[model samples]
Target: MTSRALDELPSRNPTGAFRATDRADPYWGGMFATGISDGWVSASQHRRATPEQKRWSGVPASFVTDPADALAQMRTNRHRPSILGALGAVASWRTITREQLAAITGSAVMARTYPKSLSAPFSAGLLAHGHVSAGMNRLAPARDRMSMWAVGDQIDAYARYRKSLTFAEHVAVTGGQGWDAEHRFDRHNVLTTELALRVAEYCDVATVLGEKQMALPALLAAAGIEAAQADLGRKPDAGIVRRDGLVIAVETTASVGRGFRGKVAKWAQILQRHPTYELPLVVLVVDASTPSQATSAAAKNTTTAEIQAAIREAVRDYPGTALNRTADRIGMVPWPTWFPAPHEATAGFLDLTASFLARGHGRDEGWRQMRLLDPGEMPYREGTTAAGETIATNARLLAATPHWLRTGTVPRTDQYLVDQASASDIEVLSSPRVPDRMTGPGFTQSVAGRKWRHMIRLDRTHRESAA
Candidate 1:
């Protein structure tokens, strides 16, 4: 086979199915096709000790050894985006099943030719399959079917690809405890990663920082402050940063059970000191109700009033000013549990976020009332019917428009808004030249506006203090 053809192998294979080119070939023993490694040692098992070219028998001579290099080489390949999505998901979720990874990345076929594959030796060992120990359960099946996983050390090359060693550094900072929970599946972290992935479809994946990536101590060190100044309390589940210096901290919750107050208390701590971290807005993403939360009328399944009351109770002993600041700077939005988000769900959250942003900027009347409509193109909005039940899932953001104010309406698909903003000189908010549009003194004198202004003023104070 030609060298170029070997490299294109991954793109040719179908998602979730890896196979050899010719069944008659001696090396083509239907190994990968049946999900058996055939006792082949993975590159990760080698720990970079052996020469990959020699070790990876039957692998393409041109297949990259570094995961970053592997992804870089696949720039023109159809699966590059899916590969990136996989890497990003791993960075947050840490330990995910192969099925989940396939769903998140939208591809399972990483290897094309017999023994030559992007999922193994060619990619600097981006992922590893390991024992899913069901401790002391002798009755457990002989094999763990969901074996594929991405560990912090295994995927470091992707961090190198992003040219941000900080991503890898924090993984070490936590002693990689996040991945240590091998036996139990952390639905919360997995769900959070899913949310981040969904949000990333709209913005730069690099800009969507997961909580594990935003370790407080590491952040303080990067900002030139002593790590000791900050306690490793609760941090945002994810952070979305705009080029215009707007940072939205996201906190997600799936349960409102007995421990709900404790979670709120932790959140209050972060919100109370948000200015120190330069986090101006904290968005609470309430996932669909669990059985317990749904049945409990008092818990109220993630309503704004319920969360606000919890926040008030958490900081009741604090000064009135602090209480007000905490309440004003925080906003609660329902995370669309509906299959594809309802048009109103998307519009409501965006308008709320925009309204918060429009507080200080006078010319942002357009932004305050900004809205996003589905245009009937969203595949998941209408949902699917199966087993005589209609199911609505969650909404995923498609394109990011940092300059939505100037653009009028933002499109919810890929490349349209991002490319339009970059290719044209349409006074984009992403550029520093549009500072006045981002910062000024003119908003409605409504009580809500005044409250937002108050929150911004305090945010400014905290940022200045940190500086």
Candidate 2:
């Protein structure tokens, strides 16, 4: 970030390294530097190049090795208004001159996301991240946002994502076929690797995120590490091989749903049996939007604390109420992205990781088993908000509402919402309709399965004609 440091970075990528970074990218601001010997290189925002950036940013890439230095750099560089504003503009799918961001400061999150962009051509992926209802009031942390941008790798993923729009109706995406059908987190490879960099800071462990794809066991053996399971299958977010030769599996999730509870319980049983098999899970539920009347000062603490309580309530029944003894191995270290102190709050990731490593190895039989990540140490990557991002989604029909008076049968869904231009209001009515769409509220029970996009009448009128 200083003059001499900039002088040390290569001005040109002589390797023609196939590295990629563009300020125009929407998610994962830029590619994580993999196998790069140097640190990060800033992206150019202007259509034209600046003489200063040309000399400084040499497409810098790095697999973060040192936690303290990497996090501090992220915290310090977060103040660089030029990049911060550029990312906001990119997410909103707008273009602004670097000069505009130069004066930006204070709560750095943009007010609106893809909803306003929902109609925009650029939001084809629908990048509905974090809070869905936050139209013009969405807030993002600078450290988390900027750090994520530094790991941008969205181009190839965009190509495949564009094709998902053409998916046919009535398609059945059983198994994992439907999960990767759309572009969820295109930069997840870089995102996970950045997380490992932070983990490497506290303990001696090799991460699976940044390693080049090779035979799994071969890679682990080469690194002198071992996995508790034969397949360290891409299930866990990140894991490390500690110096003491123990494998600590790390998982972070935005959803505290039943699925998450089951995952925690699986690891809980694993740790309970193995005892020293420490798994630190970081659960960050993005706080709700500020109250319409709440001032910025009040919204900061209140919203985050409320979210924290919601997490506690969700975790209350983990593994079940009867299994309190089994649940003690699983703990929570809450990292609230509390208000103006976003940067400091995120640094908690490092604090939590250090605490776990220092006290683990079958030690604190009862201390908060899974230490919630400190937000500060979270600089290696962004704290996830939502588990899913709609790069491509099953469509919702825009057809006019059927006249129940004439049709005599309502569609077969549990409920349906109709908005009529002639009516003064719109109403979401509960109905006997069935399986309207694959990606909406009724997905779980819709036996028609994923990619099905129509609701039909439950009446025998259509059934008799089949004969």
Q: Which candidate achieves the best TM-score against the true structure?
A: 1
RMSD of each: 19.0, 22.1
Tell me the lDDT of candidate 2. 0.27
What TM-score quantifies how close candidate 2 is to the native fold?
0.29
* Steric clash count of candidate 2: 26
lDDT (Cα, tens digit) per residue for candidate 1, span 322-413: 32344434444434322122111232432223222232235312212222111121111212233001000001111111111111222122
Off by over 4 Å in 1: 1-88, 95-186, 203-206, 227-230, 257-260, 274-285, 291-308, 318-324, 337-345, 351-467
**Candidate 2 weakest lDDT stretch, 10 residues:** 397-406
Residues 176-233, candidate 2: write the lDDT tens digits.
1221222133233233333333233232222222121222343344345465574364
TM-score of each: 0.42, 0.29
Those runs of model 2 whose alpha carbons end farther than 4 Å from true positions after fitting are 1-183, 186-193, 198-234, 240-242, 277-329, 334-349, 353-467
Please, what's the RMSD in Å of model 2? 22.1
